[model samples]
Target: MKKLLLGSVCGLGLAAGPALAADLGVPVRAAPVAVVVPGFSWTGFYVGANAGYGGGKFDYPFNAFQRQLQAEAPAIESRLDGRLGLTSGGFILGGQLGYLYQFDNRLVAGVEADFQWSGIEGRLSGTGTLTGTGTLPGTFSLDAGSQVRWFGTLRARLGYAWDRALLYATGGLAYGQVRSHADISAANGGTPIPGLTGGVATSHTRWGWTVGAGLEYALTQNWSFKTEYLYVDLGTSNVLSSAVDDPGNGFSAGASMKVTTRFHTVRAGINYRF
Candidate 1:
């Protein structure tokens, strides 16, 4: 009976030792796996403000204008000295609304609309010298002034984001209200002769287009700051005159004046993502 008990204990000990050894095999640890993606996100609406530099090309068509004066009266000839390329500097404050879509490959695309309040005032002036031989045999001089049409654009922005920063370009339709003013004066016999001197101020809301580029840096999870430059080309429009008292004939002739303007502006702005 004793020998049988001892044999049973020895067999149980051997079985337990093998079970412990098997449990300790390999010392396994779970391998690390991907759990999250890294990329840019634009899942909300944003707004901001910015300030910077603005410049561009400008032109006014005054060639036919002077010819018209030459044809009207042989003694009347007008020439413009500086009538275009007026540099401007100002500030723009506005907001943006848009939706962002991110591709699976980390490519982000968004469509946004922005409106700006502009302080952009551009000025151009000209000097005209008229010679009267039939009636007066002396040279008379006159001066001209400029006008500013203040307006902004509704644009769409397309950008590429690298982590927290975005490099982008924007373009779309632009519209604004422009105000123009001009002065015409003359001199006779070395004394100021107030012949025909007045100003025409007209405000018109015109439509055009704009294009630009910019860079933005993220300030927070839902906010960003940006500095951008835009070039806006508002084509020519005509300015007409209503019936009024005429200086020479008590009759007013309707004249169509052409206006063409361009601009380059930069601004720093902040945006909040919704």
Candidate 2:
């Protein structure tokens, strides 16, 4: 009886030992994943292409005689107010590369240069009455036709950044190139007679300043999107009158155009943070 009891105890011990070993063989649990926070180390270089609409207002200050004649001229008689209004809507493309310095409180300051190939233009017409011993009073009408101007800006930015989004304002130097044209005519008994048709093309690069604000949001670790508005004053340029000599006028008028352009752009771009 003692031998039989010993064998049964040995069998129970073997079975219990296998069960304990199986529990010990289980794999260890994995640690939780680490969250990646965007850092202020976006101090690398980047390039991007953007297309958006651009528009601006322009003023052409007239001479004393021109202003007086314009005021007295009938609205239907023909005249282009020396002002070019709200003319905007063009495609803009450019690239940017800059260095960003981040402070302890997440404020970022940087310098950037941006350029654009633009197509923005406007047209205006004006008529002045010609007085002489004619049987009926006649009118001399001068019409400024469609003129195209292309411009670009280079700026520096300062802003506060929140992880994947940045709200900032920028101001810096601006530059551009433009072309102008005009058409002149005379009216007899309301019958239009075309006079001098001439134009001038000028390649101008001016040193000006710009101020704008923008919001840039990150779409991915390597890509960002932005919307911005910039106000620019490209200083002034002289645009000579086209029909100065058609009627042998001894003194031809020269118009000084003071150009101020404001651009609002919405763009999507990709940047590789280094």
Off by over 4 Å in 1: 1-38, 63-83, 124-126, 131-150, 187-196, 238-257
Q: Candidate 2's C-alpha lDDT? A: 0.58
lDDT string for model 2 (123-210, tens) is 6676676443324345665555323355667778889878878889898888777555545455557764332233444445566677
Please report, as a residue range, the 10-residue window in candidate 2 with the lowest summed lDDT: 62-71
> How do the residues 172-197 of candidate 1 rate in per-residue lDDT, one tens digit apiece?
88877666554444344554333333
Clashes, model 2? 7
TM-score of 2: 0.64
lDDT of 2 at 170: 93
